[model samples]
Target: MRPIHPNAPGHGHSYSRSHIPVHDEAKAHLIASANHSRIVSIAAQKFRRRENVIARIRLVLRILSLLLCSGILIVLGQAVMVYYKHKDYVVKHNGTPDLRLWPRGLNMKPTLVMLGASVAATVASAVLGVASFSKAVRHITRVGNVVTVLFSTFCIAIWVAAAVYFKIDDFDKTKHYDFLSYTCARRHDQVLDNAVGNLGNLCAQMRASWWGALAESVVEIVSLATVVWAWWVGKRGGKYQKIGVEMLGSG
Candidate 1:
């Protein structure tokens, strides 16, 4: 029998074309897709981590502000009450003395404004801080940041006014009384001491309240800074995402 060549016309079997190029092309495409997915996943993870860190920082700052603002509110409330009690004593002791002679700067209106502003700040910070933990609600953090900044600004203004004007002309100048006179028991007149029991303590309380207001302002400023930081980070992250998408599309 003659040898039958594989490529002979009568041959029933023949070699198919090699599929190496097509296989390699397909594999390359698959690898490219996987790499793109991996890159995107990594980028997403980094973004989430950064976001979480910012959120946590915001939460801490807000909590601090909440505590400080609440403390300020409490101090102011006590000071107002103590002043009224002293007034009551004066009225009972002196037989309806002139209201004009009372302390100059402890007006109830301003005190109430301070109290109301503090309460507003406290509630806003508390609500936003609690919302930071939820991924679903975290989307609203940016809005919360804006709201926080507004609240902080308002609170700072109010607190600064209160601190500066609190009991401005109430202390006795004859005894060398200065802004901090009552704070340290430097002024001890018999009348005020007799009318307001523990007069030194009341003065100290007022001083503390003013200092707390200042402290609250400081915290508010810091909180506002954090909000700005968050916005910057978010803007940067958006740019990174845009760049990443361009790179993937080009690939």
Candidate 2:
């Protein structure tokens, strides 16, 4: 008020000294706020990118799991078809069912039953497994695993029964049949006796060898292993989800 300078406030000044620092501080705060906003925007963008990548990975895994289940189902179906066809052939021909068709050394009927059951169970498991791959039904994996395990156990039991039967069926002295005319009058009786003897021996040998039973056991074991593998995969997927969450959080 004594002598107002040209640059002093309330005179012909641009700004007061006290206001200068305040303006500088305000500018600095604005710049800092802008910088913070930029950083936050960049971080958000990065987080979104990471989330997209994780989602893709999870989708791929789910597809792979579905494919695996489909493959298993196909295999089971084929096996069942072959078994039924062979069974039909034997029934039509009125011949003793070829024990060879039943896994290498198992009892015939038990093997057939086990294989049939396995096929049915495998189909059911595949359906459930596929359903589990869906985001909405992932919880079905546990049920699928249980069914698979049960099917495998049944297969093992079938093999065991076949083995027991094989132990009782004798192969040696088993008779062969020829539907042709015979020369000797006693040929018919001899042939018949031989056939009965051969069948008895074959049965005894089948009971003794235990090949069919072993086949069922092996198949069951594989089924059980598959179930275990599926369970592990599901667990791994759960871990991946946690990792994905952490990745997003960090981003």
Candidate 3:
């Protein structure tokens, strides 16, 4: 081996100039790799955060959906029961006493029609609301949620109005029957009085429908407000999701 100088250009103690370029390249590669890893980690974390938010929103929506369905079903069920009970009363008392003096009790067909409309609207609203939560169609979802909220509000309003009207009508009928019973009783007609009294008793029993109607109205109004709130929240969530998508795309 040759004896090398201490300041040799490419030998012994002197660093190779070529190695500096390689070292710089290695350092650049390492920095780029670290940047890529950091970006990936940040993206993953953001995705997870968005997913958690969406999951929480979905959970809240499901709970609201259940409550809405339950409330509507309960009101509808009670309306149906009242309809059947009234029908039975009318049929059973067809030939008894002087019920003809008073106006006939409520006709159930109109109530049925109202209930049918309300149920149909509510079902549509629920279906749309559920569909609106899909990320693939978030814009459509926003529109659908808006429409659903409107429909739900309309249905609730209709039901509340109908129930209030029905309650008022029931009160009127009750008053009429009471007067008839009192008049017949004062006339010293025992058989007629007994029949009228029994009929009045039936009317009194039906008074509970008024209370039920009021309760249903309150529930429906609250449900309407909740649906509106959900719609607003969903809209906000959709906006956030859109922002997230844009950020991801840009990144």
List the candidate 2 regions with Cα displacement exceeding 4 Å: 1-140, 168-210
Candidate 2 per-residue lDDT over residues 1-251, each given as its tens digit? 58757766566745654557777867776666666555556555654454344334434433443343344334434433443444333111245543222223223443344345444544644564565455443322555556555655754664466345423323322321111111111233433334233333333332222343354456456656655555555555555555545544443
Please count the clashing residue pairs in each candidate, in the order shown. 0, 28, 0
TM-score of 3: 0.40
lDDT of 1 by residue, 28-117 (tens): 767766776776677677767777776666667667877887887777677667656564433244666454224455345545566676
How many clashes show up in model 3? 0
Better of 1 and 3 by TM-score: 1
Cα lDDT of model 3 by residue, 37-58, tens digit: 5665665565556545544554
Among the numbered candidates, top lDDT falls to 1
Taking all chains together, each candidate's TM-score versus the true structure is 0.67, 0.35, 0.40
**What's the C-alpha lDDT at position 251 in model 3?**
36
lDDT of each: 0.64, 0.44, 0.49
Error of 1 at 227 (Å): 2.6
lDDT of 2 at 129: 50
Between candidates 1 and 2, name the one with more favorable TM-score.
1
Q: Compare candidates 2 and 3 on lDDT and give the better one.
A: 3
